[model samples]
Target: MTPERREEPGRRKALAFTVLVHAGLIAALFLGVQWKRSQPDVVEVELWSSRPTPAMQPAPPPPPPEPEVKPEPKPEPKVEPPPPATPEIAIKEDKKKPEPKKPEPKPEPKPEPKKPEPKPEPKKPEPKPEAKTQPAPDFSEMLKRESSERTARTNAASAQQLANAARAESELRAAADKKGMQDYAAKIRGKVRGNIVLPQSIQGNPEAVFEVIQLPSGEVLSVTLKRSSGNPGLDAAIERAILKSSPLPKPDNPALYQRTLEIRYRPFEE
Candidate 1:
């Protein structure tokens, strides 16, 4: 069958459904309209006139009260004290008060008198020609002495520089010797330190100084305590350590070895 014919049933069903829905909506609208109609409508109308209306008048005020009648106050009885008998003793006229004396005007001081002018003395005639002017002294010798002094100062400065150079050289040599001695002393210290054995009772940093006599072969011949530490045990321990460390390490240079060495031992110095 054709498409229109085949859709006829569906179209009819849709139309019928739409009609039923429209009818139901219309019925509901009609019922709502009837209900609104049933309820009475309120109409409000306001009329305006071009001319103004008259205002209301207020009531009038009450009348005033009648005048009051007051009785006159009785006159107070006169109780005058007998007028004091006119002060029988005569009143002397008031003594005239003395007028204050006006201060006298101060006299102006007179100006100081002018001093008399002094007469000038007459000048005496100039002295006649006398001795002739002295001749200027020569400065050549002074100049020569100054030159000599300058030359001497230069020479002295040169000599001082040479002396300073010599002293510097000596100081350098001494410093080198001191450094070598320090190294040798450090080596001996290390050796002795290794041999030292401190007691547990020893506390604080007690220092012991020893005068060590040694041979060039690095043998410690004698150990003499020069300064003893506060603790006798520490001092003894240091002496023993020095002796035990005989044949200590030798310096690189044999000449650096000293016959007597002052050694300061401190157990706390690590």
Candidate 2:
């Protein structure tokens, strides 16, 4: 059979199946025509295309910076050694010169004692006036009393003289008398006389006294007082009169002569 063109339904079916198959295979083998229809559009970026550009070209990382080493602080400038201390000069001990001993203090002079002021002498007491004394009454009464005593004394002496002279020879008696006479003349000195000063109150008293000085030859010397004047003037005159009458008669016996020669002057009872 050449296959007479006949139409079988099955075969048509078979033919349709074959055509669909071939067409499906042809559609799957498309030549780059992308026929995309109704799926939503989607965009996808590649990772390598979106990288950012750097602002500066980075240097390869430098070797790690060296760690800063701090240098130790320099030691403070060394202090210069102080100049060697000057050695204390040991001066040789000077021989101890002893200080001269202080001069001994001069002793102060003693102050002169002050003189005492002269005190006024007390005035002497004036003498008081003395009361007058009364003169003796009746000068002759005193004279007579004194004369009586005198005369008796003379008489006794006269007796003694006679007795003593009686034993001597006449030549011896004469020689003694002459010797006494010679002494009597020599007793007077200085002008013609000497006067015995008697108090005026006693001019009238007849009490008598005599001076009988012995010569070198032991002879009785002289006598002259007498009683003749009544006035004091005349009585005073009589005292002078006696000294002026130097020599007088001599006695034979020396004892009688010496004992009696104090011639008493009776000047008050004329």
Best by TM-score: 1
Positional deviation of residue 94's Cα in model 2 after best superposition, in angstroms: 99
Model 2 RMSD in angstroms: 91.3
Q: Output the worst ten-in-a-row residue range by lDDT, candidate 1.
A: 88-97
**What is the model-wide C-alpha lDDT for candidate 1?**
0.48
User: Residues 142-240, candidate 1, lDDT per residue (tens digit)?
Assistant: 454456556555655665555555556555654555465556666766666667777667677765656678888878899886556678988887788
Name the regions of candidate 1 deviating beyond 4 angstroms. 1-165
Best by lDDT: 1
The 10-residue segment of model 2 with minimum total lDDT is 84-93
